[model samples]
Target: MQTDNSYANTFATDSDAELVLPSHPAQAREPQWLAFNAELAGQLGIPESLHTTAAGLGLYSGTELPDWIQPVALGYAGHQFANFVPRLGDGRALLLTEIIAPDGERFDLQLKGSGTTPFSRGGDGKAPLGPVMREFLVSEAMHALGVPTTRALAAVVTGDWVQRDEAQPGAIITRVAKSHLRIGTAQFVAHKITQGADESLRQAFADYVIARHYPLSKDRKHPYRALLRQIIDQQAHTVALWMSLGFVHGVMNTDNMTLSGETIDYGPCAFMENYDPNAVFSAIDRAGRYAYQNQPGIALWNLARLAEAWLPLLAKSGESQQQLIEAATELVHEFPIRYEAYYDQKMAFKLGLNSVTAETQALTRDWLSLLQDHALDYTQSFRQLADTLETNVEHFEKMQSWAAWQQRWHKLLTLQGDSDAVVSARMRQHNPAVIPRNHWVEAAIKQTVASGDLTIFNELTQVLRTPYDVVPLELSRYAEPAAPEKRVTRTFCGT
Candidate 1:
């Protein structure tokens, strides 16, 4: 791997030393590649020779690195499941390096499940093969689905076992992201300043964040406040996309949310097969705190926490704490309105409406109610709806309420003066025929672990690459919902 690029070492050399702790990845005993994202590698201009070379495997698998490369475990604090943990950071992940693409975009190349860190917090830092595969498949699937998310670079299994419920095969996944900075990172610095650390630390950290993610904020009169507003807008857009796709993030803790606006943590996340607002798949989310419908609220709550972390920086020289709080609160309150605007626009297209209006909003509400009441598959129902529009097929004929909603949708399309074919085409563009279904993910993980068979895993990844396309006959099973007996009701963080 080439390490001499001009911008390759920017984060390592430029970020405030106080923000990151230098660390080393535990060398794997028998590192082996389980999967490599050749497409992503090509996009990054990685040499083809590096794809399967022993030296390349060592670098990505946390077994070996060039002497010049200095990995660090980032430090941050977060609210995990509404409880404020003052210090929670990258327990098993290490930032190996940063890559600046040929197009001038920068991405962090991090090795998750690498080894112990100062922030490991007494737990084993090794990740099991199951979660490694889970993140790799689901994150890549999210990218194909057009959800902003961190991409998987590679998957590797160390011929070592880590105890988690039982001894499981240890593994690592190379994650690619715009940046790994999170709201929790700011929270750490703000907390440090509150506890007698120099105020300049906060300023330095904030400036780094603005420079990396929101450079335009620097020109604003109140740059800190502008940064808060930008993060709020990003969270709104990302969460709205999640809602549109029936994805329950399962954990909306401030730490899991990225300043870059991409979905970061994939632990315990799942797609809702049945359109139930109360749907939650995380085994640990016992209270339904991060349910499918509750995601928007949780997103706003997390942003509020980020705003709280920025109070010191947001304050003017002579501003009182209360004044600063009120100012930040005002900006945080913009989240719901912004979220609704994004959600409505996406939903409008999903229903074959070219634009959102009061009429379309009302129609959407009823359509959701129908789905929830009938427990319709969230993804398939939309694809089926498009078919109904084109063929007058009455896919939901068995339900009495279906006819009324169908008639209303058809009439609205007619009044709006868009042809059925045109509207249906638009709907297909917005609604995907496939998602990373929990059962499929589980089966793939199980098969790979039990027998080292990647046939199912590889095929599933290929089908997900074109989720918006009509399902071909050979891939029909991938587009279908899980069978009742095979349904996976709960997902785990798999730390």
Candidate 2:
């Protein structure tokens, strides 16, 4: 019985994935050489503590893949999608150690796309280089966008390859998150209920979550229920954050949904270019189950699955269970109002209004409608509106209703004592100067991978990092809408 580095540390070993790498040493250096992954600024300062192992760098860095960093099989079950799966651990992942930062915040270092585990389900447990790079690029972009999300620490193209879609080489990506516990993990143990054992599991799960993410709520009597509410709030804000920025988490499975409320499982995710609202990119989502518009609903549905797992903790007459169901359902019910309020509030702020009022609601809709009607780019439209409102009268006049909107906006400014500079400055912060536009991402991907060019990727990343900054040189190129012919309708999952 070999205990891994994780077990040796304060953390317990839970799951393991196979060690796989890309076939070409030169190919693996795809990112740093071309895109140049900025060495990942360590805002958390947590990873520095880990006894660094050989997670080979571009092509292959001297980092020896540590021998004792054994794979740990994690235990958990969940309702995958809608089906009740009794067992589903890390099918292709292993828990690396938990690093406690100087600030006392603990973060998990997991090796995904590493190798197969007991749960690989006869599929190749290895990940291709493309997905690894994609996740790395997108996750960093998400972090910069100010969304609560799991971050990618580093990507290594192991000097190994595994056959998948024409024998592509394998790669390893290091994913860091605040916590690895998901709704599925709670359900896995709860499903093992022998009589009143379910209640015991919920109690344990609640204690675990409260201790980690919501420590302040641990002593409460119904701590589990409270944890659910906290998760609900975070998830509501998270999904709103996604929508406001046109992000689409193509797969929102219960197992993929993290209790920490940070977005995870970027298996099939993309951002909308044309704002279909119901746009989906995952190849598997034929029924549009996880569309952009449906994220909040699917989120509530996932929460229901979690509530069902905790039902055993309720009571004998099933009366306690019913109350628990109501509690969970009420939170789910709160999703729409909460989501709408957030979206409207954000949209209001973007439109330079203090809050969502009847006047502002109409103004906001008119703006979106104008963009949609002209097939104007979603991000650019909002961002440019702020700049145009401030400087260019001709550009503002061409947008038909802007003059009237400006007048009404002025009236509302009276509500805030309307100082032009103050209002312009506030709106600029609300509207980002740049976003990971689909076309821009695709172009960068092509330049870096196809043409072996680093300029586009470097420029995009530089501009993306300071989304709110208005650097004239970077802003014009970064903020411009994609050419009509270049607009990408659908993005593919980088499997």
After superposition on all CA atoms, what RMSD does each candidate show versus the true structure?
2.1, 5.2
* Candidate 1, superposed: residue stretches over 4 Å from native: 1-18, 317-320
Q: Backbone collision count in every prediction?
A: 0, 17
The lDDT of each candidate is 0.86, 0.65
Worst window of 10 by summed lDDT in candidate 2: 17-26
Per-model TM values vs. the true structure: 0.96, 0.83
Give a tens-digit lDDT track for model 2, residues 4-90: 233223223211211111111123333321222434424445233332333334212213344544345455666655777777777
Candidate achieving the largest TM-score: 1
Clash pairs (backbone) in predicted model 1: none
The regions of model 2 sitting more than 4 angstroms off are 1-41, 44-70, 73-81, 194-199, 314-321, 393-406, 451-454, 471-478
lDDT of 1 by residue, 1-495 (tens): 343322224333534434577789998999988999999988877777668789779888878786756788888898888888878878999987777677767788889999999889997888999999989999999999998999998999998998989988999999999888898888887777777776777777778778878999999999999998998898899999999999989888989999989998899999999899999899999999998989998888988888887777788788888888888899999999999999999999999887888989999999999888888898999888888865655548887688888888888888889887898899899999999899999999999899999988998989988999987899789889988999999988878
